[model samples]
Target: MDWIDWGDAPTWLGAVFAAAAAGAAVWTLKSQRDQIDEQRRFIAEQSMNLGLERQALLAAAQERHEAQARKIRLYPQAPTYVQVVNDSDDPIYDVHCEARGMPALHAVELAPSEGVGAGILADLVQGASRPYVHRLGVGREAWFHVVTNERGAVHIRFTDAAGNKWVCDDAGGLHEAGA
Candidate 1:
């Protein structure tokens, strides 16, 4: 029996081993890339959730502020006088009352409807203020004309404790007033 020579067999085996090592390195790199992409996706989702939560918190704060503004009430006791009441725990500032036309929804005293406006507060109102009612020929000389009638509503603008300005009407319509 003759033993056959296995020349260069070790070098051939080394080449095969090198190829396998290269393949394993490529697989490891691909796995790492996939993991990085998955992490990026997770981070993006978390950011969007945080943004939505922030928006919800802001909306809730605005609702609470408007609720505080609704505590003020205005009514006409007689033709000569008006009854202004503040039901809230906190005092509101710069309160201005005006009679708006029903059709146009415009304030009658639009000209000086600021600090020196008629039927308005020159100073910060604390609780209840009984001021002289202005003579309005519309709706039987009522300080606050009802929405049920053809006459307009009585609206009041005031500043809240948080420095937010608001405008509310006797008919339950409320909105944020811009500076």
Candidate 2:
């Protein structure tokens, strides 16, 4: 009997090639997944850093605003006497005080009825004196006077004819005129 000639290749060659292809496909998929995960992690890190930077900037700005607000709130508003020492020997002295949180003194009218401008400091320095007689005239006891003592330093205090006293300095705001 005549038998047909068979190819010299192994019967399992096709199956082996198919298995290798499947394995390579799985490995390629895993590698792609790993790359995608790394990209996602980098994006997340950048976002977190950006958020932190924004928070820090906002906090710094808020701190500065609060400090300025505190300064404005604490600054004196009532009649305040500020003595400035000039370094230059310029004969023309400049007395400059910004109203800041206080009402502008330029438009203020110190009348007897106001009960605020009768003080000697307002009348003498500001030239805003009224005709009404002071219950306690301007003197050592007046509640508004700046006196230059024997020393080069200047002294200022508020004294009422009724013997009320008030003084201002680094210690703190003036003690009540009568206190």
Candidate 3:
């Protein structure tokens, strides 16, 4: 192999290589720093946008529910319009005219002597203990489980039974008692 001549190398060539290496190092470092700053800025912007978008979505959903007339009407106007919802999906029994208006108060009563109306009454009376009164929506709206199996209250309301009123929940549970 031929021996390399370090002395013969041009003096300016070494300076040129050193200058280029330094320039390249500076460029690489600056580029990396700039990229890190840009990424941080991008992440911060996304977080702010997400928070705003979440609030907007919640507001929109609330607006949609509030705009519905039927849902609005479902909210009780008086304390008596509410009934305590038992945590069951059974049929309603012993529907009386007095129970029709809002629950006004929760009270326990003897089972109706007449027994529940034929069809749904049979189902509602199942496992039904002494009659109980629970003021629904007394202080606030309540989420009651509606039982639609028995239609006695529905029929009475449709036929216009005098002194007979009914409270129907959104889910179709109807309560009635002689007023």
Q: Which candidate is the best by lDDT?
A: 1
Pairs of residues at least 3 apart in sequence or in different chains that clash in candidate 1 = none
Compared with the true structure, what per-residue lDDT tens digits does model 2 show for residues 32-113? 9999999999989999999999999999976653331122111232334332121221111112122232322321222233
Which of the predicted structures, 2 or 3, would earn the higher lDDT when compared with the native? 3
- After superposition, candidate 1 runs with Cα above 4 Å error: 1-7, 74-84, 101-151
lDDT of 3: 0.38
lDDT of 3 by residue, 61-172 (tens): 7554333211211322122222223222222233322233322222222222322234423333352322332322212222211232122321112111122244444444
Residue 141 in model 1: lDDT: 17
lDDT of 1 at 56: 96
Overall lDDT per candidate, in order of appearance? 0.53, 0.37, 0.38
TM-score of each: 0.60, 0.38, 0.35
Error of 3 at 161 (Å): 26
